[model samples]
Target: MTLLWIITALWAVSFSLIGVYISGQVDDTIAVTTRMFLALLIFLPFWRPAPWRKSLRMMATGAVEIGLTYLFLYQSYHYLSVPELLLFTIFTPLYVSLFSDLLARRWPRQFWAPALLAVAGAAVIRWTDLSGDYWIGFAFIQAANACFAFGQVWYRQQSMGNPLPHRARFAWFFLGAFIIAGSAMLLTADWSKLPATPVQQGVLLWLGVVTSGLGYLGWSYGSTKVSAQQLAVMNNMLIPAGILVNVLFWGGHIEQWPRLLLGCACLAAALWLCRKRTPAPSRST
Candidate 1:
């Protein structure tokens, strides 16, 4: 749980950095491909041989979660403003709760309240007037949300019983992401929009190494420690955290501090509620 919170803070800054330094300037496919390859290299040295089936599963998870999710998310920017995208992500907590419950073949009714509360909290933080290709953009964001939610739940439920440590096996995950993202980059990336400034390169490097590499590693491991309800609510923590990051570092405006505070209070109440419930351990653990 501590680890998840730490990475959540780290990723909060990542949202602003990517928007400011990479979003429009760098090709989305190339950016994602570079980040995956760099993250793959980070875990490569720790890699140990594992059963083919287990490696393949990890790779598949990465492909859907990181690779496909990024593809949908980046493309959505073409049709939706950042505020609209953030607003759409409010559905992800529900997806996480539903998918995690489905994968377990049992529904914990207690899980839904906190998850929905988190959604309400996020909606408060990012709610705004919408415009421009509403249905198309909503569909793209939902696809990304579903992929991300499914990946997290699926990975948390996998049981390989392999001897290798998770860190050692994580290379396969990034390798899978690399296969998808790299292929996409090769097919569609605009070489003309590659990062030109040192600031852009540095930002990409930080994103790849710290944000993608360490961030995903921490998040995956952290998911193993908490209940499904906790995980679901935690997904919404990013909304307030990212907004705070922008307000602090990116000169972004926050028009309604009272609403922001109310939203954060709701998130806190949800987290507390989840913590008080008895944690139902996943079978894989």
Candidate 2:
């Protein structure tokens, strides 16, 4: 849980960085592809061969979770403001809880309350007018949200039999992401819009190495440590954290004081409720 909190903060910054530095300046496909490729490279030195079946599953998970999710997310930025994007992702906690229960074949009803509470909290934070293209952007974000939630739950439940350590096997995950994102880049990338400035290159490197590489690794590992219910609620923590980052550093036009405090209170209440409901014993993976 501590690891998750740390990664959540890191990811909050990433949301703003992508919006401010990368989204408009770089082609979405190219950015996604480069990020995944660089992340893959970081783990390549530790890679070891695994069973073909397990490798395939990890790859597919990465493809949908990181690769396809990023595709929709970056595209949505074309129409939505950064705060709108963050607000739209409030639905993700519900998706995460639903998918986790469905995959586990056991409905944990306790999760729904916290998940919904988190949604309400996030909704309170972004209570404002919508853009003309709001629905279109909303649809894209929902697709990304569902994919990401499903992937995390699926990966958490997977069983690896005496396989290499997660770090050693993690390269397969990014390899899968690279395959999808790389293909998309080939199909749609604008050669003309490639990173032209030192800042762009630096941002790309930071995103690839620190954000994508370490962030995903830490997040994936952390997911294994908590209950699905806890994971569901924790997903919303990003909303407030990201909003704070946007407001502070990205010049986001949010009413800064009372609303933010109320939202944080709601999120904290949700997390507290989740902690009270003890999670089931960890499943063998």
Candidate 3:
């Protein structure tokens, strides 16, 4: 959970950086590929070949979670407006709950309640007028959300019985992610849009090294320390955090302060409801 909070705080800055720097200046495919490649480099030296099966599963997790999630996300911008993309992502917590339920073959209402509340909280912060266009983008964003949710649930469940340290074998995770993003870059990247300015290159370097590299690793490892409900709640924490960061640093305005506060209150309540009196680590990762 500490890791989750740290990553969330760092990623708040990352979102703004992408919006201000890399979104239009660089080819999306190239940017994604570079981030994955750099992240892979971070953990590549730690990869041990002795645990081939575990490495394969880790690769599969990365491929679905960050790899396909980002791919679908970027592609969706072509079909949907930015507001639509943001709005659609609010349901990610719901997917986290649903996927966890499906994987366990049991639907617990208690788990679903907090997840829905998190969704409501995120929706409150993000709700706005819809353009009624780009319905296709809705599907794309949902796919992205499900990929992320499923990956978190899958990793948390599997990591319980695995005795290896997460850092020891995390390289394969980024290798699979790089494979997916690199393939997309090869197929669709526009070479002319590659970073033309020092600032753009610097931003990519920071995002790849710090944001994507450490952020993803921290988020995945942290998921192992909490319950599914807590993970679901944490998934929506980024909304208010991002908004606060934007308002403070980027001169963003709140259209409705009361609405934002109310949404945050809902999120806080949801998190509290999921809290346990005696906290236990799911397993020592």
TM-score, per-candidate, Cα-based: 0.81, 0.83, 0.79
- Candidate 3: give the clashing pairs: none
Q: State each model's C-alpha RMSD to the native.
A: 4.2, 3.8, 4.7
Tell me the tens digit of each residue's lDDT in model 3 across 6-40.
Answer: 99899778766776677767888888888888888
In angstroms, give how far residue 33 of model 2 lies from its true place.
0.5
**Model 2: residues >4 Å from true position, as ranges?**
106-132, 159-162, 255-285
**Count of steric clashes across candidates, in order:** 0, 0, 0
State how far residue 145 of model 2 sits from its true place (Å).
Answer: 0.9
Candidate 2 lDDT tens digits, 5-24? 99999999999999999998
Q: Evaluate residue 210 in candidate 1 and report its C-alpha lDDT on the 0 to 100 scale.
A: 95
Residue 222, model 1: lDDT of: 90
TM-score of 1: 0.81
Scored against the true structure, residue 216 in model 1 reaches a CA lDDT of 90
Better candidate by TM-score, 2 or 3? 2
